[model samples]
Target: MGHINNKYYLGFEGEPEIIFTVVQKNNEKSEISIWSGYFNNIMQQITPVEGKWTALAYYYNLNIGWYDESPWLVDNIEDAYKQFKSIDKYKLDDLEEEILEEILELFKKSIEENNNVYISYE
Candidate 1:
C-alpha cells in the first residue's frame, strides 16, 4: 500500500489540559484539525490579499499543515506573536480567520505560562 498522510496540524490555546502543538496548545479538539492540503490552498489564496503575511515563515510556523505527524516546536512564542500581530483578520474567510485567532490565542497562553504545547497526528 502507498503511504497516505491522513493528518496535518493546527495550533491552539492553553488550558493546562491539552497536549498541544510545539509552538502552542489547546482548549478544544475541533480547534486542532487535520488538514493536510487545506492550509496550502487557503493560505496561498489569503496571503496575497493580506500582503503583510505573504513572506513570513514564522506565520507558516503556526500552521504545521505540511508536516505529517510532526509538531512545530517553536523556541520563542513571543517573537512569533510580535511578527504575527499585524495580520489583517478581515482579509481571511471566516474559517481561516478563526484558525489564525486560535493560533494567536495559543501563543498568548504559551508565553504567559512559559510552557510549550505541542501536537502530532497519526
Candidate 2:
C-alpha cells in the first residue's frame, strides 16, 4: 500500500500559509522536486466568501504561453492585489486601511517595474 504525505503550517490569518511539499510513495520510490517558498506572503488574509476574494493564484508565469501576451505584468505585492481585485471584484475592507494602502502602493511599484507577482489562496 502507498500513501500521500503532505504537511503545512497555519499563518496568522488561520490559513495554510505554507505547503511544504507533496510526496508520493510506490514500489519504485522517487521524490518530486518542489520549490519551497513558492507561495510566501503572496496572499492577503481575506475570506473568499465574504471579502470578495477568490481561491485562485493571481500571478501567471511570463515564461508560459498566453501570459506573454500582456507586456505589463504585476511583479510586486501591491500590483498583485490590484490584479486580484480585477479578477475577483472583491474589496479588502476587512483588512486595515493602512495595510490595503501599502499593498496598493507596492502593486503600483511592481507594475512600473514590470515585475510578475503572484498570490495563492489559503
Candidate 3:
C-alpha cells in the first residue's frame, strides 16, 4: 500500500554497510519489491529519498564531535574514506560526491564479496 514498507541491510560478513530501515510510511505491504525499487533507485540515482536510510547522514551523526587523531575507527578502505570525511563535520544535507561514492562502493563491495545485499523485512 505504501511506497516503502520494509527494512533492508546491504552488508558483508554479518555487518551492515547500508541499513535501509523504514523510518516513516503510511501503510504496510508484505512485498519486498517496493524496497527493491528504492534500492535500485538509490543505486541508479533515479529519485530523491524521502525518508529512507542515508549513509552519509549516518556517518555525520555518528562522528560529530568525535575526538582523537582519528575520530572513528574504520574497517575497510571505503569505511576509511567515510570516517575521514565525517571527521569534524556538522551538516546533514548536501552530501559530498566522494562520500556518495563511498556509500555506493559499500553496496558494490558486498556484491563483489559474494555477500547477500538484502536483509529480511523489518
| Best-fitting candidate, scored by lDDT | 1
User: Per-residue alpha-carbon lDDT of model 2 for 1-122, expressed as tens digits?
Assistant: 32222222213445433221111222322111111232322234333445453223332221231133322322334534545444322333322333334445535544565444332223
Worst lDDT 10-window in candidate 1: 11-20
Ranking, lDDT, top scorer first: 1, 3, 2
Best by TM-score: 1
- In model 2, the Cα lDDT at residue 81 comes to 56
Which clashing pairs does model 1 show? Answer: 12-25, 20-117, 20-118, 20-119, 21-117, 21-118, 21-119, 22-118
- True-structure Cα RMSD, model 3: 16.2
Per-residue lDDT of model 1, residues 1-122, tens digit only: 21222223434322111123533234322234535343443334433335454333434545443243345355555766654465676766776666666667766776896767454433
lDDT of 3 at 14: 47
Show where candidate 3 strays beyond 4 Å.
Answer: 1-44, 47-99, 119-122
Q: Candidate 1: misplaced stretches above 4 Å? A: 1-31, 41-69, 119-122
Using all chains and alpha carbons, the TM-scores for the candidates as numbered come to 0.50, 0.30, 0.23
The C-alpha stretches of model 2 lying farther than 4 A from their native spots are 1-95
Candidate 3: worst-modelled 10 consecutive residues by lDDT: 65-74
- Tens-digit lDDT string for candidate 3 (63-116): 331122222322233432343344432322233333444345544554355333
